[model samples]
Target chain A: MGIKINVERTSAPKEKPEISQLGFGKFFTDHMFIMDYDSGEGWHHPRIVPYQQILMDPAAKVFHYGQTVFEGMKAYKTPDGRILMFRPYKNLQRLNRSNTRLSIPSLDEGLVMEALKQLIKVDEDWIPSELGTSLYIRPFVIATQATLGVSPSEKYHFMIILSPVGSYYEEGINPVSIYVESEYVRAVTGGVGNAKTGGNYAAGLKAQQEATEKGYSQVLWLDGVHRKYIEEVGSMNVFFKIGNKVVTPALNGSILEGVTRDSVIRVLRHWNIEVEEKTISIDELVAAYRSGTLEEAFGTGTAAVISPIGELNWQGDKLSLNGGRTGPLASKVYDFLTGVQRGTVEDPFGWIEKV
Target chain B: MGIKINVERTSAPKEKPEISQLGFGKFFTDHMFIMDYDSGEGWHHPRIVPYQQILMDPAAKVFHYGQTVFEGMKAYKTPDGRILMFRPYKNLQRLNRSNTRLSIPSLDEGLVMEALKQLIKVDEDWIPSELGTSLYIRPFVIATQATLGVSPSEKYHFMIILSPVGSYYEEGINPVSIYVESEYVRAVTGGVGNAKTGGNYAAGLKAQQEATEKGYSQVLWLDGVHRKYIEEVGSMNVFFKIGNKVVTPALNGSILEGVTRDSVIRVLRHWNIEVEEKTISIDELVAAYRSGTLEEAFGTGTAAVISPIGELNWQGDKLSLNGGRTGPLASKVYDFLTGVQRGTVEDPFGWIEKV
Candidate 1:
């Protein structure tokens, strides 16, 4: 259940790049952490190897069958220069949940945590100090067995790579316009929707591209059954505010149970706000928006804690909420979440893990 | 658009194995074909390298984004001892169609054919001589750029591998019972439903596993909107015989335009059978089955020429079709397709292409 590390080091970057100029997932650190697992041998050969090419056969299961899963989280740099990683164990648990759905082997959480700590410990300088900027951590597992049959692979590889990233909203936190896709479905029941797997993102890419083409920021995918109920956005869980109640789509096995989403629920509950998890249909939301009762809407994820949604275009009908900007509840939630991450607020839940 | 080959040959197998004992996608030949493409330099450095592991960055885009596509076709040994591939150009066209959906660059069909010819000439001994056995060819393209971003990849790699395969049905073309999955959707309209990409197959694997768990061979997916219209079975196109009409689902974007499906349509039309492509819902199929008008039901694909469906279990109700064996229409269609593929019958449509 534990990892075995074989350590290797690399020279740091010669020129420390500016955090503001950093793009998403382009530049990597000097080293990466890796672990391998087979059916017979559980987990072995954990190492902090130099960031380099990994040799794999063309027929490897990941290439053909897409039996791969990944997690996205960030390590924050506090004002006092102390680095903190937010709830890494939650990410590892979600990774295992994704593994069960894809039929890939799962490694122990302690092993993954140790691997992340080792990598971060070795490459701490890569963490950005900007207000919204931090070191983006990507941990992924892939099926590596060289076979071409349409089944899961017996051998797997898990690796973690770090990249310095700036704020996702470069133009400040303005509410965005999203397209409601009624014709396309991202994930369905009994599918790998709840799992943060590559297929879910892959299925949403075309629709997302369509949204981009149609002059929207992202796509809001509806359920496959009736194309009426709201499921989720492309990579984030959705939350809607109508009057005083905050409602979201229930965890119906087809929508990813985002870590940020769960945290928002806990934080809102702590604040004594009425939070409800139930079936939220598009028709009802449209009616609420038309009646001027839908206070605000936003998306939650690790990349951006809260992205306010000000407009939605569902099948050629346009609707706006809160006058195309952040609403009262959205601002409060964003401030609270970011404040906790940046160590500006009280830490009652101990959500931040100091390294 | 063109490939430049650098041939590096490896020693052949110690001894040629019997073709009858060959399995599917397990054994490979000595040398494999490789090619590379970039936006700045286009395609360059094509090679017949040894079948080996591909060294790639752990954060490669293919692993994270599932931006991958593949084509599956086979090369056959003629009775005259000359090796030929069936519909190679069709595979190339389908590969490009897949590329358009994945936003990857397309390779020239002529270059692909030439490279495949050179590789087949080198590994001619790997082609099985048995009646139902042949050399299975897999050509795949993957995003190889070392980035973790969500946008399209700037660099890609295309490679081809060959494996000797026996019959797809081990029990000698036994009719299989299928489960109609109403809750799960494989592909939807305006999605990558028609592309030969990794995401579609990944989505189907879960349904396939569920069918297997429920004592069925495969799961039949319905239309995403209504969940009542019959779309397809896992990895195959569906066909039904109601009275004198040979009804199949239309070529909707949510359904793959299978090459075998096209051939069957052409053959049925040529034979003057009342073949129609329209939406066939589950309720209509159930009514037909009950009224004794559902003469036969079968699934068509490249793996199994035409597999008969004995029973369909929809929502816990098992509806038996024509007994648990091959029907007259299925046998005729199977014989016609196999004969054309084996070069034993006249190919009036000129669908078969010689390597």
Candidate 2:
């Protein structure tokens, strides 16, 4: 169904800085989109209001029960100067999936798409034209009912905010060392692990700090059972390249079904490379490393795009992969994914949505 | 180190209703205790502000990274017209434990105690005098940093909000049916499951819902490693009484060290009841039930001080406990604990703190 759209503008920022110096999630555009849902009156008061702090009761359910869900995508300024979004439909689908898991109400996908387009058009100037830079769009839903009961909230709020961001990695695509936390399980079967909710990231902060203190960049969480099988990192999906065959952990109910992960698999298939999504345990990986068959490892996500995993430290044992740098497969995957996202490569699957 | 607490009071509710009509966390006291902490400033800005909505950034670190901690305790109006808290120091100690685990800064316990005293003195009328009624105090700490990076926040806000809560079991104290979630794990060895953070509750919501959908009141989570050992139920520490011996799951790295759990052990030892805080698996409990040795099963926490477990459904197998209602041991334990909380019993351990 088509969604009714409205726009309310805000006074422009006093000074819009040059796009090169902009940071991630630091600056907001002129407007934000919001809608409310109640048990009696379903989904009322949709508006594009001025960007500002949200006034919330100190006892909001989102703060207590963590009843929240979010989506992250970018509005890229193409060479032709037109604003666009990569796989907007995928983001919409994943947002609904997250809502279902979190017990929050889901909006119509078509309405979300239309509202996103309206918001992007109203704040089109926020889109940066610099290479590898774009306006990040964050659409999140929270339980806004003023009650402290543990069950699901009867009322909710859906809001979208925009921020201009430069490249994630300041350096030119440097490889990262990741810490393997075998004792901590990020997700478990029958848990809300496959959803894009805020709690998943919140649960990973301690491990992330441990990795940072150990001079690693990110954490690699293992399966809840056994704690040996490879699971996705909290922020990104992981992939391993052993010789010519590519393998990733199967979506074992606890791993998120990432949009970029799907795209990567599709691209690999298009290139006629063998892509396997199955359970790959660390023991197998270690044996492969010893035999010199594990050629490369990389992480995939919206923010990081593709991150090369050079070395992994688990239980005081460090294993270096592909000479501690980005390997051939990782480099090619990076260039190809970035090219597709930036509209520099031919769109074979019509994943780009023009705004 | 003394704190100069300046209590600014607000008008109470227009008409104080009877304690029976009170709901869970709906109505609150007039004033709230708040303090701020910063990297350089340390803990400052201690004030009693009118209970109002807080203007928070949409990208606050607590909303994104779950850098939040909370403690749950109650204020009881004794028969002799005294407002008291059941071992407030225990809550302070547990709050510090949770804060340290989540990387959130800790507060001075004495300062926290003084703040509570000032707050209760200002709103003492909110404490209910009826049996099993209480003024639930929720002391929560949240990261107020505006940035979105996945790390500990530099600034924090600590606030205590009070609500009049009626009895948890409106149908009178009775046993509840629980679903044994053998497939899902609440926490891992190195995980933040033991901490009272939003993430652990968020991760447990789906399983709780699943259990509720299957006609159970709560989900009994298992250890992350083997999913065989019992962890906790909903938000309480569990105990199994077999052959006149009280056995609870040991305080493993992943299990929360609950205040009630400690108190129960202390009381049992005082009453000459054998108690052990050792690992108790589901298989052993089921076997005891089969052999007719399991006398009683109960859960203890701030809310629902002692909840009897009537039945257990584990992986399509059902086991019934003694007397589908409150057992003798559970009743005695519940009454004795509430007696100490309400100041009807002598506090040999000096657990009660009068506000």
Query: What is the TM-score of each candidate's chain B when compared with the real chain B?
Result: 0.95, 0.97
- Model 2 bad stretches (over 4 Å): A12-14, B11-15, B315-318
lDDT by residue for model 1 over B261-301, one digit each (tens)?
A: 88888899999998999999999999999899998899988
TM-score of model 1 (CA atoms): 0.91
What DockQ, between 0 and 1, does each candidate earn? 0.56, 0.57
Global CA lDDT of candidate 2, please? 0.82
Between which residue pairs do clashes occur in model 1?
A54-B56, A56-B54
Please give, for residues A1-355, the per-residue lDDT of candidate 2 as tens digits.
3566677778655356677677667677878899999989877788898887888787877777678888888888888887778998989998998888877777888888888889888888778888778788888888777666567778888888888887665554677888888766677766677887766776777778778898988889888768888998648899999989999999988898888899899998999999999998989988998899999998998877888888988778888988998999888988887777778888898988888
Q: Candidate 1 - CAPRI tier? A: medium
For model 2, residues B1-355, the per-residue Cα lDDT tens digits are 3778667666544366667678677778788898999999988888887777888877777766667788889999999899889889989998998888877788999998888888887888878888878888888888888765567788888988888888665544789988999765677766777888776776777778789899998888888767789989878899989997999999887778888999999999999999988888889988998899998888888877898998889888877888676789999989898998899987888888888
Candidate 2 chain A lowest-lDDT run of ten: A166-175
Clashing pairs in 2: none
Question: Model 1, range A1-355, lDDT digits (tens) per residue?
Answer: 2456778987644366776578677788888988888989887889998787788988888899888999999898888988888878888999998887777777788878888888998889888887777899999988888877776678888999999887565445678899999876887775677888776776777777778899898889898767788999768899999988999999998899899999999999999999999999999999998888898999998987899998999889988878888988989989888888878787778899987
Candidate 1 runs further than 4 Å off: A1-3, A11-16, A310-323, B1-6, B11-17, B286-295, B310-323
lDDT of model 2 at position A22 = 77
